[model samples]
Target chain A: MTTRILTPEELALLSLVQDELVPSYGDLPPAGTLGAALTVDAYLAEQPRLRRPVLTTLRAIEVRAGKAPFAELDAGRRVEVLRKVENADPESFSELVKQTYNAYYTRPDIQASLGIDNPPQPLGFELPAFDESRLSRVRAMGKLWRDD
Target chain B: MAAPELDSDVLIVGSGASGAAAAWSLSRGGLRVTCLEQGRWVDPSEYAHSRPDYELARQTSFAKDPNVRGWAADYPINNSGTPIYPLMVNAVGGSTVHWSGHFPRMRPSDFRVRTLDGVADDWPFTYWDLEPYYDLNDSMVGVSGLAGDPANPPRSPRQTPPLAFDAGCEAYLRGLENLGWHWWPCDNALISEPFGENRSPCNCCGPCDIGCPIGAMSSAHVTYWPKALAQGVQLITHARVEQITVDHAGQATGALYYDDHGVRRSHTAGVVVMAANGVGTPRLLLNSTSARFPNGLANNSGVVGAYLMFHPVAFVSGVFEEVVNGQRGPIGGLMNCQEFYETDLARGFVRGFELQLSRSVGPLSVANGGILGHPVPWGSEHHEALRSRYAHTMTTSVMLEDLPEPENRVTLDPELTDAHGIPAPRVEYRAGENTQRMLEFSIARARELFEAAGAVEILVDPLVQESGWHLMGTCRMGDDPERSVINGWGQAHECSNLFVIDGSTFTTSAAVNPTSTIQAVALRCADWLGRNYRDVAA
Candidate 1:
């Protein structure tokens, strides 16, 4: 049986952060829409060392949001609250950002949006033809190393 | 209480680059050769690049650092004493399974560093002595490179045409031309086109570091091991060698090892060759203490694990406007500049470094702190940065030459042990002043090259601690028995029947990658042993 590491409220807070970080840009979906927060949760569950710090950082951000829950706050207010948390603990915030990006960028939908069809796999990409002309100057230089 | 014993004419430990080459060369001479590899053969079907979540392999199965990868066969090393953590693979092909296939030969000047630059000790043999072997190994591995590289001395032609250059390579070439510096297509072990029966052409999968599935990359498993196996060389996988047993006369008799099921076993051989790499070789020797040699098995000179060296690396990345499509080709550098490879007294360093231009890493790799200077920002700025820099960045890796320091040695950890209850190898290293100066100069040169290429943003990462792949000089070769463990022929000075054919026997850490040279030296060692096998066996 699998244990859930993130609380429902904490997962909601993380989803809010993910949406703000990688929001919808025209046709592109936000990171939350792609389920990046759930991926991050799965990753943190396996990595016991990172779970405590990540959960603590999210809690601090929740407190900084004030008045309303972090998930209910407006985008502008959420950004302001995140800015305060980032300034206070840049290392933890940076680590969270890296984790979020790692989860978001590896999604199949995101990969499709980036035009990378399929994993670079059983059939790899074709490269440009080799050009011998590029070696003209190097050949003309002719044996630059000293023998002695 | 007795271990089961097997017998062979020759016992080779570790089936990596050097061991596999030696096995192929010696097995062809009609001698019964047996090789013991700690790790099992990698199945081509299980290669990470074929899966949907291939990018995550960099942190899991394909990680450069073994501790991070956490394979069962891997042993932990105490890296507290050294600034850089030593990295190696334990599979049959060893680190070659995860290498980028950059095959560069050490220059003629690299052999005589003491005579030329007065910094490191000179190798007993010269570059000319190993030229034929180098050519032979190149032919066997099927190198894909152009002939007539001006930076290197004249050599035999490569087996195939060089890999095609992408836009990133062209930009780097233009930058080198603008500075009037020497640059050339890198000699890669990856086959550009199908030539030999053993392998096929590379498909530009861009993940050569995680074991090529199509047998395009020249790993030992696809190159030498196949030939060795065909020649009837017995290969035992998942066999962790514990120590080399010696006779009373101080000659190598056999080796004690742990089998796949952790059962104790032994292999008796006329000649025992230790090709277990720099760190593993030293650890084995240090642990093989007996009544005759209290300090170690071959420690008469008390230098069994002394004079360790590694190539200190510096990285620089440049952001260009044009999309370079960095994910299409080999992950190794597309081009290399060796203009500053020779020593210059004016540069405040005795030796120099090589500048290789690399394309941007995969999307996940870059997002997880693989970028050099700045952290990836959050919010809308994060998406903007990724869109612009995803396929547009070019990196330059500066591989600096490191001199041997006696204090920078490998010793057995007093408390730490592997799964087999053998003491783990402990690394003690600190970069010398010369290496530090060379790194600074190389980073500056990389920045200049980026500027010359007309990059908008230049990022520099100087002297990362995790870049310790080139292991050498632990059991260095020399004529002086009092100071060196092995001789010119890779025969141990204390034990005539014992030989070490690997990066461990290197006298100096050359500026270039050491894989090709290690194979060349192993081939040369096999040649010497094959010629004198009758007398050695007697």
Candidate 2:
């Protein structure tokens, strides 16, 4: 039961928030389309310390919606609920947003889209060799050290 | 039951920068040296940058702040009043294992603060007195820089070429050039040319602070400890010294420590060296209460943990329209403008600051939130925000000179303690008025530079809380025993055979980083101890 952390309805609500946080634009799909919420769900299970804060933010928005589940709220109402939660408890709001992005961007597909397939190591980026000619003008000034 | 106590000719309390240098110097003079280090020796292969999840490790195991990355070896620090958080790593190399490797020597006037600015007291020794030692350390560490920098005195030519300013850094150089301000290529411990078989030339990994993926960066573990070990110096890892044990006659006998398996043990020596840095050194001294020295070990002057200093940092970043190399190359070794480093009372401050080009966020950082003042929207604008920020921004970190103030100090915290139940150190500090004034002046100057460099938007932060890397001046050295904890040549004023070779013994904190100066001073002190140990020990 601990392994299967998030309930189906809770996962659906989280997915809806993730979708709104990163909506589909151009040819790309929204975060929900890439199962970013599922990724976050797995992350939350891995880091149980984050479970309370993540749930607090989600529940705050859900409770802000009168009678309707956050997953069933209209897009405009969803934004209003999110904004209220953000205004009321910004730390928790920011926490969920940060974790969502971490889950999203670390995906293989997202890395491909960002044009950085490999990590920064093993094959680091190429930088232009520093040209010493840049020193000619500055070198002419000579020993500006304050010795007096 | 306690373990059998060991004895040595010389006992060093830490295996970090100063300890490594002291060990190597003393062993070369044919002394038996044994170093007790609290932390494990981190494998280079296990460094953060070697894995794909590099940035993640920085938030966890490899974090500079001991508080955030609560490894077993780390001690808690209470940074309540000060804006800057104490950032350090508890490993064989200490914080140098995770440093950005920006090595700059202090200017000549730095040692004569009272004579120059009428503020803090002068150091017991002058920069010229230490110049030869600095050159020796530079040669031993394999620094990369161009000599003949107008801002500092002439020196031996750098071993390798400096990391060239990339397309993005050129923007700032052009801005400074247009403004006619003095700028220079920064000296760095990070090597640009290949040296020994173990180390290779830089791979241009952007996150060098997370422990260099390649051995290009100079750290004590890679640079000095190898030579010291080759000279037959004994390094005992996971030996956390809790107290500097003193003999019945009030001389430093050795240390009492917890071994790897948590067994209490003692090691006696003819001479004792304290290289555990500003916070740790003072903490150990204060905790070592006794019949002869109830106040602390060699602390009869009551200045064991006084005059703590940190280069209070303020970050100024700018957003530009054109995207250049975002996360490539060495961050700290690129370029620096020291136009305002020397004291100029007319600028509304007695001392001044240095503006060094710093890091921009990686893709994950941008995705989290754009910048300090700028927030990236998550919806339709997320990609655009990430693209605009990652690699497209330039940050100039203003390092303000922290004058020595008795109030800005590290004291034993009343409530907090480390894992082994030793009372942790708490920092009671506030940015002095002079430092604040320098920040305002530097901010305006950075804004002008950014505008001149054609930045579309400028971001300003008054203080960077996580920028406290240069730790110094908790157990200062001076000529008078009444006015200082230690004296010239880093010998404790109260205990004859006791020595302090770490940043704790600094008299003043310059605006520049302290790694190179600390090593140079350590070399000088080790040389003195090697020559005069017979008199002191007797």
**Top candidate (DockQ):** 1
- Lowest summed-lDDT stretch of 10 residues in model 2 chain B? B1-10
lDDT of each: 0.85, 0.82
* Candidate with maximal lDDT: 1
TM-score of each: 0.95, 0.96
Residue-pair clashes per candidate: 0, 2
lDDT of 2 by residue, A10-128 (tens): 78888889888887766778887778788778878876767888899888877898798786777888888888888899888887887787777766566667676677777777777
Which residue segments of model 1 deviate by more than 4 Å? Answer: A1-4, A45-53, A59-68, A72-77, A80-94, B1-6, B371-374
lDDT per residue, candidate 2, B419-523, as tens digits? Answer: 788899998888888888888899999888889888887888878878888889988989988768888799999898889999998898988989999999999
DockQ of each: 0.68, 0.64
List ranges where model 2 is wrong by over 4 Å: A1-8, A42-49, B1-6, B369-375
Query: Which CAPRI level is candidate 2?
Result: medium
Cα deviation at B320, candidate 2, in Å, is 1.4
